[model samples]
Target: MSCMQHLVALLALCLSLAAVAASSNHLPGGVNLNERFFNQVRALIKRRMQEKNCARVHCPLSNVHLQPPLVDDEVALQNQRSYDNVPIPAASVPTPVLVENWPTEQHSFGQVTAVSVDPLGNPVIFHRAERYWDVNTFNESNIYYLIEYGPIKEKTIYLLDSKTGAIKSGWGSNMFYMPHGMTIDIHGNYWITDVAMHQAFKFKPFGSKPLLTIGKRFRPGSSVKHLCKPTSIAVATTGEFFIADGYCNSRILKFNAAGKLLRTIPQPPEFLSLQVPHAITLLEHLDLLCIADRENMRVVCPKAGLKSSHGEGEPAATIQEPDLGRVFGVASYGDIVFAVNGPTSMLPVCGFTIDPRSEAIIGHWGDFKNPHSMAVSVNGSALYVTEIGNNHQTNRVWKYVLA
Candidate 1:
């Protein structure tokens, strides 16, 4: 059939589907498939048109204008706009020195998204293989168009020796689309999130099959049973966990041991709404949950056990220092919270050590190009960071030891 015929048929199918949904009142999962469904259909149609135009010109639109052009002065103004009056931290924590010649072998990766140290001190890495998230990656519904791009067949998970950066073992082939956050629980269970899949999975250590999975596969919704682009997972000893429902839904979700939804944790009133709870870490000792609120460019901490009605509560503390600079990931070692931020127009990419109690920036570190997620060692002696790199050119797993 011609393109015009296909478009007409699609529109007719959409109308029929809408009518059926309206008559049923809601979808099978109790999702109100109303205007949102129509919006998704429209977005799909628009994307098809854009792709056709690009094909006609023999140029891919996805390669054009990935980032907005900014002049030096504009970048400087944006970097100084938010925290001009805030005082920079004076006292420095123990400097973290990069371990040279680490990861002993040269291995190529595609957008390493997350890294965590296992109980045996091996750094487990979650990467995207060859898949890349771009403007056309997801539709308005936040569901990845996987039919156009097949699932990655390569193993996306890797375990490396902490001392030598040598591969200990690797698994997770034919699994995961866009690997995001990952964590190893006390019981040796691996918890991971996939933004493209819109779900979180719990796997037995070194096992390929998921022991438990959260969210409907490839379906994005605000309902309790569904998650839109989940970014991070933080699990407790008791098996209770929290997930950062990222990108589209900017909120934190809590679940019980058996993968049952508990409730959505409320963001602080100060943030009328969270832009992106991109990464989250639990401070078990301090009984606090800290999140890297990415677009807000701050770290928000609230009492881990605090409960409120209808997702409303105040944070125990927050860190919004100028040096914080677009936090992408947050990790905690004891009471001190560590955060990594990508570069702005003016500032270079760096990380910060914050005293959560005082909400002060205590220490600073640099030398990262595009740090996505980070993890501190069990003994607090070393730090593991995964960088997505620019255009997936420098996908690397970095290790730093306290000096």
Candidate 2:
């Protein structure tokens, strides 16, 4: 027999022997030793299988190019401690004013999950249509199990004119289970994440079918072939992309243009363990990859191409304000970073701009019911925010322009 078959047979023999022994001898306190032993063996086998699968699927990196340091070593040390003493910019910072009666037609939506400005400056929205995410949307394994009224046929992707907000085109019918995040790469390709599908997709401009798909269908795993409820994706000009495997696996995974596994971004020692990396935004000008560490209520900015011997590196900067609430999304225009947060006991629902270098809160804007995701215009003249809406009703996307 082959090596794998022989190993499997050996494991089966050991399990059988354990079962026989456990049935004959009872553990103290009336515990069922057979059940306990079986559960332990099952967990061990599952973990080993996952590791094997990951090793088999992922390609090893022999040499990784690292980006130059964002700052001198001494200055970097100072910035590391800047979080506690960040200077609060004056209130004179400009806050974008909401444009009223926008979209003109006032199209209705179910739950606006994500919004991104395409290369042509048009806003593309990813919504849930008639589907809703609730307590039972995912089972214990983080696999989407709630299918209501069969498959939803509504178009989930909508491309609107940047000026008039009129729908230019729409597609994505009968595809995706639960839409979570969307981003338009520099090349105009759409990178989207589906929490229910546990997958990320890359679609050509106005394309109905995806040109590339990552992760296994309906399977939630941390292996190279599986993603556990991935939340968002950010693509670099070089075609390298980062995916926030948020819901279950709290890690950002990097992949190449052809969808090859690259590496799992290492969490910075200074920051708390990632709870849920809800959104990711790449600041190309600054060579920074920023993440919305949702439950941790912080934005971790790591050097874009920085890698260690193992093809992973620490974050260069972070924004963790007590009053920032739960940061739901992050976007960047030039060196300026923009973040939006849901309401909390200490702060109202608001969006704020930050100076990435100084890690300071520069400006703030508010009045959102539930700001879930956002996108900034290429020229830094406008911002678009998507709201899941209150009570699962009044789902809307709002546009704001810099004054």
Candidate 3:
């Protein structure tokens, strides 16, 4: 017989012998049944088995008892004396299975929108926290208390040290109106989006001052400066940036190194019918910009200038959105782009990779709910996702080791 077949036969023979030996044993309850029986079976397997995946083998002795070690008569007396006819209280819920190695990061009251690996391999999470002051004016909650008579909404961006699991640095004290998106560029500048403020801002690595603003005095109902909301951002290798104009606006705004508006790529009429343009990416070749048309549920590719609309150089191709509905973050590795799906109210973050050439979804896996944002490692094998779940009552981030 072949080697594998021979090994299988040997295992079968050993199991049969074990069955016979176990049945023949008649040890009393006082015997150390777990120690003796398990040791014997383990010894047998080690001598005969040569499986690569097998590091160790285990054999159960019998059903494990819940009672503390004591004489049978003693246990019966305690049970009988408990009460007249009252029964022992039973646990109402089933025990939960604990997972090892996987650690969870929790935040009190903030939504993590962006994450990047620091120099030491720890993650830096940027979250927009809310501070309530009455009902009318509440900016994104950076501080915990309400402003006496301040704006109903004030948004702030914080730089959190995921390693120490603390807020490392914060900038937007009373500055931001609705800080929705942020990214750390190669030059170390932080690019943030303030949709309510109608501006895209660039700040020095932890600086509170805004280095530059894209749309000043921009407001809704006016296409001159910006439409209504500005949502997400992406930076290219050369330091140029793309802003996904969200809400009332449906366009991709491009800026140069000096932060001057270079061009505007308005969305196709078909896509503008949707609500927001959430995330954008500059393809590796510098040949195009990939726009995550959030409401439209598709990634749109536009050539260099990203002109007004797609005719020839825009959207070289497009991929159909996954069934998960809306996508928040888009990252590219080689020729594939990965998207994070589901809301922040659940678990089992879902992700899918797309093959740009075929405009086809290459792979998909489920089990995530309410993942606020996601980022892929420089190498393409690992994906990090931030989760905000309700019942869990935790704001956490998880890393998935991709096969």
lDDT tens per residue, model 1, 105-188: 887888899999888777889888878888888887776877456668988888898878887788888777888889988777
- Summarize candidate 3's per-residue lDDT along 328-403 as a digit string, tens digits: 7676655556676555221224566655544444445434556656655554445566665443345565665545
TM per prediction: 0.73, 0.75, 0.61
Weakest lDDT window of 10 consecutive positions for candidate 3: 87-96
The reply for model 2, stretches above 4 Å from the true place, is 1-94, 147-150, 267-272, 306-312, 390-393
Global CA lDDT computed for model 3: 0.54
lDDT accuracy of residue 359 in candidate 2: 61
lDDT of 2 by residue, 185-221 (tens): 8788899898888899999976877899988878889
Worst 10 residues of 1 by lDDT: 81-90
The per-residue C-alpha lDDT of model 2 at residue 46 equals 56
What are the clashing pairs of model 2?
A: none
- Answer with 2 or 3, whichever has the higher lDDT: 2
